[model samples]
Target: MSESSDRLQRRSAPKRLTADDWADAALAALAERGLAAVAVEPLAARLGTTKGSFYWHFANRDALVAAALARWEEVSTERIIRAMETAEPDPAARLGALLRGATLSVVDDPLEVRLLAAGDHPEVAAALARVTERRIGYLAHLFELLGFPAPEARHRGFFAYTSYLGHAQVAHAVPGAVPTDPAYLAAVTAALLKR
Candidate 1:
């Protein structure tokens, strides 16, 4: 092909994967095969690229893992919280929505379970702790807004969080076991909130 033609072809080709892309692929790998599966070579293959592409964005595997965890935190916790707050003005409704949203499992996004399983890693542990605290704190605040005392709110928040975690674990272990019906979820929310 002529020089101009070659240049046009190259320009039209897909752009190189960004660090975010690599991190996303790493998170997918982590979800599919646990933490150990998040390696440079495998993720590169998963992305239909090479290690060179990964190395361009990350210094090493650990950096990639950290990036993936950070991305998870942003999407799973921060963004969810932001969306929840904006979606509902009432604290009680927001809390119910959060619980319902959390219980609905997304097949492609099972990173929470994977991360909890791999929580021994310092990065995973730290991320898990941050997310757990953030979620529980928000829940507690909602409970307080609903007229629960500070200690009682915190206790209810912890109970709600543990129930969530347990439900997630059970859902993962036994598909279709965790009820996703709106009525069931409403019942769960009402029982948890004691409303």
Candidate 2:
């Protein structure tokens, strides 16, 4: 075989797909086509692989869905919270930053809206519940730091979270109406953080 043929053969060889790759593809499917779209065969086709590759990583479709939700929580919620904690030491500033980040763009965070829509599914419901509790708890802690009483802090936390959910839902519904301006985000952050 000539050198060019060898190079062409190497380029045509299949790339090995990992569990993360499957989970990521599943997430994209979930975001684009609801949770029902996340199937082994469809995802395998999307990845340009076979069902065998999926089975190599996950036991079944449910397992892949669970993995995708876990990955979403890790990257979207946990990672963002960690970054905020590190970047903003002041509780007020941290809360403002969190609100600003949450309201950044509805289109940019379609996965969140998709997950909310899939909340009827057992695994999706459980994952949503866990994420909701975690986010509320963190926001409550920040409120406490800002000197609010425990009950009040919890109330404020719920308010903030619900506001975010409402905004996300609206944005998803009418993508064009949702403002992406920094001033709009700042105004939202101020309103949410107001005692």
Assess every candidate by TM-score: 0.91, 0.89
Predictions in order: lDDT: 0.87, 0.88
| Maximum-lDDT candidate | 2
Where model 1 places Cα greater than 4 Å from the true spot, the runs are 1-11, 106-108
User: What clash count goes with each model?
Assistant: 0, 0
Model number with the top TM-score: 1
lDDT of each residue in 87-184, candidate 1, tens digit only: 89999899888988888854225777888999899999999999899989989998999999999999999998998888888788887777788998
- Writing each residue's lDDT as its tens digit, candidate 2 over 105-174 gives 4557688999998889999999999999999999999999999899999999999899888889888898
| Residue pairs of candidate 2 with colliding backbone atoms | none
Model 1 error, position 29 (Å):
0.5
Off by over 4 Å in 2: 1-13
Please report the TM-score between candidate 1 and the true structure. 0.91
